[model samples]
Target chain A: MDTIIQCENITHYYGQKMIYEHLNFEVARGKILGLLGKNGTGKTTIINILTGYLKPRAGICRIFGEAMERLSPAAKSRIGLLLEGHVQHAYFNIEQIEKFYSRFFPQWKREAYYELLKKLQVTPVQKISTMSCGQRSQVALGLLFAQDPDLLILDDFSMGLDPGYRRLFVEYLKEYITAENKTVFLTSHIIQDMELLIDDCIILDFGRILLHEPTSYILERFRRFRFDSDAPAFPANDILRNTERIGTHWETYSFASAAEVERELVKNGATVSRLSEDKLSLEDAFIGLTGKY
Target chain B: MYTSLFYKEWIKARKLLLLLLVVFAAAVAYTLLTTIKQFHANPVAFWEFIVENNSIRTGYMRYLPLGAGILLAIVQLTPEMHNRRLKLTLHLPLDESKILCSMSGFGLALLSGLFILSGTALLLGLRIYFCPEIVYSDFIASLPWWMGGFTAYLLTVWICLEPVWKQRIFNAIPALCCISLFYTKALPGAYVPLLPWLTVLMTAGFFFPFYSAIRFKHGVQ
Candidate 1:
């Protein structure tokens, strides 16, 4: 698999607040890579850097093998970006927007854009500003779909989407990725949908990467273990990345297997009244990994 | 592609363009109508008034172009700035410089077209009502006002493109001061002496949006 996106030593700061320090990551060609994190955890900043909207304080962010800040016209033509808030020219209606954008890209497929537009119950003359949030998002999506670039960099696709719209978006995206096998770099706080869609994921919190792994690997290997004790006894070990106790139930999140957790707890002299394995849902895993603390 | 992009920009500003042209034409017609009415009522008195004073009699009409230029910039650039649509525009496969130039070029071209039409109307109105001597002198006096419009549009672009409030204010001060240079009391061609230098400044200021754009791209406030 060839690398399509690469970031090395990406350190950024807004005034005195540091967002990332020596951050590094990569996305392989033809893979849906999700940059998942809590709010204000620098996910959008990374997107901005990659899209050349912002030059980072110090870093090398390459998209399609070219530095993003100075992206070549050819390099730029190959990436379709769905900006946050689905920003589009509010003055343009469906037909006008299609007519407008079609001239910019050589391979623009008007049919591809209209196919998505057909899904919306909007008139050809309806301006984007007048459309509902979901409809506007669809328009933004339709434009990018028509562009048909090799890389799709979508920033927070589910931001203002309702459950139904979000689900529909995810479903469409899943099909699009599968059908096209194009590289995708997306960010979202909505983890459940991301879990279903992303091939690989990077979980970030507080300007640090908590984990970077394939979705299957993390789901199969990483888990939360519950240990109950009559008294307050919370044991910490190198294997457990995070620990939290609510009432008599002491929960431990770790990459270690259930057997390893049980062994570690026994070795630490923590008496366990009840022990059970609870597979961490992606959101739960995000919470557990970042910790409730 | 360039033509399409230009067309997109034209659509954004077309309504405002129509409004500015109507208002501008109306101002010219109003001046001409009132002067004609006065000429009909008392040709000797009005003619003597113009001949003796040798001043352009359009009072508040002089400020029309300046206001039109500022408002046109607002109509053209404000939405893009407000909702981050500039980011969408800058993302196009074309060079950012080309896009910026085309967008600004569209605004400047429309402004100049309307300003020129108004100038011609004023000249024609004066020509139809008065002799060449008065027409030439009066037209010369009004050129500063037209030039003021160009300065206002250029300055407003500078202010609109700036993302930071303080920086906009900072830029506006010099812009306001620069625009004032075009408004000093003088005969119609009084600006002829200073026009060359002012054009140099205005041309330099014309590219101020690009500076703001580069800063905006770097995420600088």
Candidate 2:
């Protein structure tokens, strides 16, 4: 598989606060990659860097195998960017906005855009500002689809959507990309919605990437072992790469077998109760890795 | 692509441009109506009055251009900056500077065109009452005001695109100083020494907003 998006040793700081440090990742062509993190973990910052809206203090981000900071307009044309909060020219009506963008892209697909937007029951002449957030997202999405870009980068696609709208968004995107040889990199706080959508995922925490791998690999191997005690010792090791401990409840992240986890926990002086094994959801793994802190 | 870029900006700017033109026309109409009355009452007195005491009308008319400049820039860029619509604009498949230039250039072109049209109207409308010399006096005196619109646009662009609020105040100082140079009251031909300087400053001021744009593009805030 060819690499479509690549970031190397990215270091960024918002004033004195470090957003990311020596962070590295990549997206394969035709792969659906999800950037998962809690608030202030620098997911949006990474997106901005990839789109060349921001320049990092150190390191380079490349899209279409070109340096993103200096990505030419030709390179940019291959990328479709959906700004956070589904932003667009609120001044233009649906038709006017579409007309405005039609001239920019050589592969502008007007029918494909209008067909998707028509489902929202919005008239072509309605101003984007006058529409609800969900409707505006549809407009943004329609424009992206119409642009026929090779890479679609959606920043917080589920920021303000109701579950129904989010489901529709995912279903439409899921159905669309399955047939096209396109790359997708999206960030979202709604992990459950993304669980069914992303093939590969990265979880970011405290300015560092905790995990970046296939979602199925993570789901299949990574297990959260919970230990309950009056005073449970915090499990820390190479085995437990990330841990979440709260009051009397403690959980440790490990890709090791159940017996290995039991041995580690027993040595750590935590009384294992039932030692139940449950398939971890993407959200669970994210929380286990990132923690409540 | 450039045509559509201009059209997009034209759509945002046309209403304000039209309104500014209308307001200017009304002012010119008033001046013409009063000029005709003065000419009818006493032609000699009317010519004497303009040549000797014309600073009053010129000062008032000059502000028209300045105000148009300020208003046009505010209407076109303020909301876009506040909502960060410039982000969407910069993401287009064109050189960032080129896009920024087109956005500001569209407003400049249309606003300049409107001011020129207003100047022409004043010249033709004043012709019914005044001689060629008198019409020239009025028209030439109002030139700075027309140019003031461009200055206002530039200043506002500087201030609007400056991402940081503290830095915007710093930018406004120089912009305001640049605009104040045009407001010095003088007769029809008195600006001969000042016009070239103002034009230079206006030409140079073209890059002020782009400074803010480059800073914004770099995430300088």
Task: Name the top lDDT candidate.
Answer: 1
RMSD of 1: 1.8
lDDT of 1: 0.84
DockQ of prediction 2: 0.74
TM-score of each: 0.96, 0.95
TM-score of chain A of 1: 0.96
What is the Å distance of residue B64 in model 1 from its true position? Answer: 1.5
Error of 2 at A10 (Å): 1.0
lDDT of 1 at B157: 84
- Per-residue CA lDDT of model 2 for A1-293, tens digit only, reads 79999999999999999998999998999999999988999998999889887889999999988998778899888898888888898989999999999999998999989999878978888888899888988898889889989999999999888888888888888877777768999998899988988999998888899889999999999888776654435546778656555566666778888798878777756566666566799888887777666
Cα lDDT tens digits, model 1, A119-224, are: 7899999998899889998898888889998999999998899999899888888888889999999998789989989989899888778789998888887788
Interface RMSD of 2: 1.2
Judge candidate 1 at residue A285 and give its lDDT: 79
CA shift at B74, candidate 1, in angstroms? 0.9
- lDDT digits (tens) for residues B164-194 of candidate 1: 8899989999989988887777655557777
- Candidate 2 local Cα displacement, residue B94, angstroms: 1.4
Q: Which number leads on TM-score? A: 1
Off by over 4 Å in 1: A230-238, B187-189
